[model samples]
Target: MVNTISHIHCQNCSMAPLCLPKNLSEGDMARLDTIIQRHKPLHKKDLLVTADAPLRYLYAVRSGSLKSYTLDDHGVEQIIDFHLPGDLVGFDALATGRHRSFTQALETTMLCEIPLNSLDDLSAEMPVLRRELMSMMSSELYTSKQLLGSLNNRAADARLAHFLLGLSQRFADRGLSGKSFRLSMTRADIGNYIGLSVETISRILSRLQHENVLLVENKLVEILAMDRLERLAG
Candidate 1:
């Protein structure tokens, strides 16, 4: 069972800058808000959507995190990407009209739901919104490409460093502390996403901690040496 969160308009959302266009007029923003549906919080491991489901709405991560994944022919889960606040989901369904991967909550999460049909009609009247949506889709594509590049031909330790730094920057972009945060996903999920083994992930993390570059205790991580971590990532 799911429970709903309180209403918060787009104009008042702190993530508006990251999730919405900067130039939207008051009227446009209000119109967009009207089309949004707020959902109850999702608990840890709850499936938000499953593969091949019809695409009814796109989701904006209001808080917490989610992981998108699909199973391989051998029945292995292939983790695609982990989404954070300000990130959008459901783009994977746009081309086929059905979801291509399973999306689930990594922890308790809040999301803003935007109906696709209503958004289509609204975007037709609001060029700004249309453009912003297109920009977001394009940005998603670019991030996917960057992830592929990061995974290719990179050493295991370098890959881990790069992944951590990427998360750090993403958190900072959301006006949160970049140097410390919780790892919403498990080590195995990180390994699967970055093309490393679970053991490799733990070993790399331990090595980093030993080097005083980061302090890791359970899921909590603190960057003790940002400069050194950046150098390692490079």
Candidate 2:
């Protein structure tokens, strides 16, 4: 459930540099902030957007994480992406005006909801805003392509290693420790996203731990050898 919360101005948000507000003039930033709405934190498993839902707001994750997935004909979930803080959600709906996948919080999450109509109007007057939005969308597309390539060509162990390395870079980009972080998605979810079985996921994790490449304590993973992990990922 979403509850209206006090606003946090774009100028004051730490994510400003990494999110939509990046490189915007003060006045433009202020205008952009007007359309962004804050909400009470979402608990684990709370759906942010459902497939085929009308496009309303594009969400900017402020904290925690979320997963976007789609169901096949058999209703099996095909996990697409895991959204961390500083990531944008809902771009998938822009072309059709309906969401293509279901996005749900993997843990407690906070978001800034940008009303689509207002953003469309505001972007007309702000070239910087428009450019930033395009850049984000392009980045999203590139990441998707990279994921597809990895799934097609990488081995199971390489896929898992690459996934962990990707997480490390994302966390580090958000000013967190690159060597250690919590995994919000369960092993099953990870396996689904990377095209592996739950048992395979467990086996690879245990193998990494045994090889002294990582220290795994339930959801907590500490990369003990980043260089070795990179080689494994390659």
TM-score of each: 0.95, 0.96
Best by lDDT: 2
Clashes of each: 2, 0
Q: Candidate 1, TM-score vs. the true structure? A: 0.95
Prediction RMSDs, each to the true structure? 1.8, 1.7
Off by over 4 Å in 1: 1-6
Candidate 1 per-residue lDDT, tens place, 107-147, comes to 99989999999999999999999999999899889888988
Cα lDDT for residue 114, candidate 1: 94
Which residue pairs does candidate 2 place in steric collision?
Answer: none
Give me the overall lDDT of model 2.
0.92
Q: For candidate 2, lDDT tens digit of each residue in 25-140?
A: 89889989888989678999999999999999999998889999999899999999999988999999999999999999999999999999999999998888899999999999
Q: Clash pairs of candidate 1?
A: 3-40, 4-40
